[model samples]
Target chain A: MCTTCGCGDGDTRIEGQGAEGWHRHADGTLHHHAQPGAHAHGATDPRRLRIEQDLLAANDAHAARNRARFAHDGIFALNLVSSPGSGKTTLLCRTIQALRGLLPVSVIEGDQQTRRDAERIRAAGAGALQVNTGKGCHLDAHMVSHAIAQLDPAPGSLLLIENVGNLVCPAAFDLGEAHKVVVLSITEGEDKPLKYPDMFAAADVMVLNKIDLAPHLSFDEAACIGYARRVNPQIRVLRTSATTGAGIDAWVDWLAAGARAAARSATQRAGPRGVVA
Target chain B: MHELSLAQSVIEIIENAAARDAFARVRKVWLEVGLLSCVEPDAMRASFEAVSRDTRAEGAVLELVAVPGRGRCPSCGTLSALAAREDACPSCGGYGLRPVAGTGLRVRELEVE
Candidate 1:
């Protein structure tokens, strides 16, 4: 019955499909109370109940479980979010290639169709899996959980979940990611952060992608970053051009630090092995 | 855009609560929706009506309570009312405004029989 949170079992239906309900008696006797709705004979009258429950509780619960799994394995999971044509794939390929000798990397590509992104990731010397969400707009925690199980990413490795290229819906679903990195391209204009404030605010890091084109375009880097900061004061900004290989080293360096921290956390959970101070 | 899916999840919550709490029908619902959340009330109501058909929450009077967003200025450490995501700090006129509330979507209460 998944008797955990309110959002249990399935989407549309209740857990118990048997037309009978369990009954309890005062004399310590148990019996089956037949009928689904007509339990009004035993039911109470109309009343208001305070149920402070999140609408996405089911998804959150799944995300919590996934978070626990990642923590156990010392995995630094990242959910890369952005609009279409934000150079997310190119940035991923660049990072994957750069991270080759440092750590083992696994990619979970989310899209409405095709395995092209997954292929690109695999070509960059990393294990990759493609999850086609069909008509689903965002990648929820349940879907990511399944992907992680299938990928079985190595302990203390990096799991980059490239979400479906949509700013709105992806912000509403948490996939148990350690960080949500939003990539915005120079061609997308500085007003993007203002236009899609929810996405910008939800992200922990904002990657200003395709920065090599800044000279040719009128994109205001300072203004763009300022707008992002307005919504998210703690968001860190990184400038990178996935094609020109500029700033990729800095991005990888930051990612390596995060991965190292994750590994240390895992080791600490297993009790400290003394060697150096 | 995801309102339809959100409505579907709401139905699931109602159905699960009904089964667990032994309630047959839900008469009313007080839904707490954050102002900063990118959800349209008209869209949510219309979608809820469609998804709640024949379910426990069918024909339920779904009311939305607008929860105001709050943002804090990083420079001056002043908190201000954030009506939307793009709202700047009223006190400092600074860019770094961190959100503290009004981003949650929850079902606050339900009238059941």
Candidate 2:
């Protein structure tokens, strides 16, 4: 029995199978355990240990490494977060199809089960990898690092990490993405931002998807944007409809600009290679 | 919701610290939870009990310190206590309130043997 959350301890696998690389422990160690009760510690005197550390320090360290790797490779990584059934995969499909030839785009799909989303991404003519988090609610930086190592995209490419569709947990766990793009469909309530402020505050861009059905539904666009702005004044809002291809151009433009900036920074950092010492 | 995972994370941190500090078992854990941290302390305690079984921290006392949320209002330049993230500034009633404190989730100290 797993000690945390009472969920059965299932090993996290990449691409729907056992991963050969070392699995990262929750404590950020890289060792395999023989069993839970196999080891025992010697009796010692009672004492206090002043461990003043952030619980997320290990995850944050992994995220820093992932961020550095992305910068070095010039990969503009965008983490897509939202509630389940918010059209994240549909948006990704549309994004991949639009930028297929113009730029090299790849996807890392995270979910509790199934390779269906990854398959859809592959059908869109972009390389895709699937990560089954098992009972985990959100993907952490270490998991993303493993996925990136397995699916090594070309330098100066776009890496779209479709996070496990969750608004709360993903906001707290940084996956080393350059920016977090939250997709909130109009079909959902406009008060979502106010209810889930942490997700909105952490997001750089809020994609108000399914706007094509706005005329049919009674969704309030202004109120939704207003609520989001209340939490995050600097958040960029984009109205989109994946079904009719509306507002896709704006999304693609934003992504292209991010990619250009990343590539430019990488070039500037390289600073005229081949200067032998 | 995610408190279970957070509880698991706490256990992992404590376990690692135990190994490094040569502690056989943990007697109590003092956790500092922020008011705006999105973690329910009761849920966290229940999760800790469930996830700490067969580990060094099993049956350990969970002492939580609730930290009040504080935000700085850009309009009035006043730091006030906030009940929620969407709360307006107490002085100016403005929306441009930046969070200043009480968002931390850390293991402040531990009593181990």
Candidate 3:
């Protein structure tokens, strides 16, 4: 279990899945037989069941469905992940304001136990739905699937998913977003990318938020990008201050480009199967 | 922790396998865990125990086979061993080490009756 969202399972293959390299004693204990199928009572003896499966198979399947649905609907979804107090919501609200109906923007807010972020997003003038994770640290694909069914976001629209403000757990779960944008406030440590490598490693864009206060703080902007590049060389870096609306234009332009690309790509195929129309 | 949920998922897989393979009892589970992946073996063990209570997988031994991370250097196209995500390529000493392997969590085999 992770201190933040949750610990995730990785993918691995175990050898000797056949009727060999395993055994069970009449009494349950750490015991093993050196040979395969040594017991004469073939039906009664414990058997080695070959079950090679991924722990996240279920979640990955759900994410694949979500990804297909988003592509089919032409929805450009972005999953925002960051540590607490990175101003993710403020930046999202301001981004909503900046778009100003350029594209229908819908937000799905993930919080452990509050509707505050959803309310803030709704107040900023966008269709917002709150998915409180309760005791859970981050949102999962099943939750997003439900939210998508309810939101029914229009085609060629923007779906901004504000993942729970926790860096560690959200990295493991894929919500079928087109991109994962990680927000790190300038007030935070510049070594965040190295300290939380998993989050930085998973993100596509590293947004340096709260840049308005950089003049007063000792934040090293270049070093942060450098660290981010070390983990993910292809990650695009962006700086913004959601309060003053500074640098929001470039952010919007990025979003517009993605939205346009999504629309163009959506028209090229009939559905997830890639059937040309 | 999502590990708790992941542990639950393991049980679900085992139970599904039980139905598919017609097994009633499980003695041990062989799990291949990626060394670079986010999963912690100790934590997963505890969580698996906590979630497997009263289930067909109760008291099942989980043997973890560690898979080390492997990276490929982009500049020289040389494959190198990776201990961590921030590790520099040993062959080229370059920062652009693309992850080629590791980071997996899967149930490989099970000992059952």
RMSD of each: 11.7, 11.1, 8.3
> Candidates' interface RMSDs, in order?
14.6, 12.8, 8.3
lDDT per residue, candidate 1, A166-213, as tens digits? 989999999999999999999999989888888988899999999989
Q: What is candidate 3's CAPRI-style docking category based on DockQ? A: acceptable
Alpha-carbon lDDT of model 1: 0.82
lDDT of 2 by residue, A170-216 (tens): 88888889999999999998999998998998899999999999988
Deviation of model 1 at A147, angstroms: 0.8
Per-residue error at B51 for model 3, in Å? 1.4
Off by over 4 Å in 2: A1-46, A272-277
Candidate 2 lDDT, B1-113, residue by residue in tens: 67888898899999889778888888778787776777766677788889999999997877665565789986788899776777788788887467887777899899886
Clashing pairs in 3: A6-B2, A10-B104, A10-B105, A11-B104, A11-B105
Per model, the share of native interface contacts recovered reads 0.61, 0.50, 0.56
Q: Tell me the deviation in Å of residue A258 in model 2.
A: 0.4
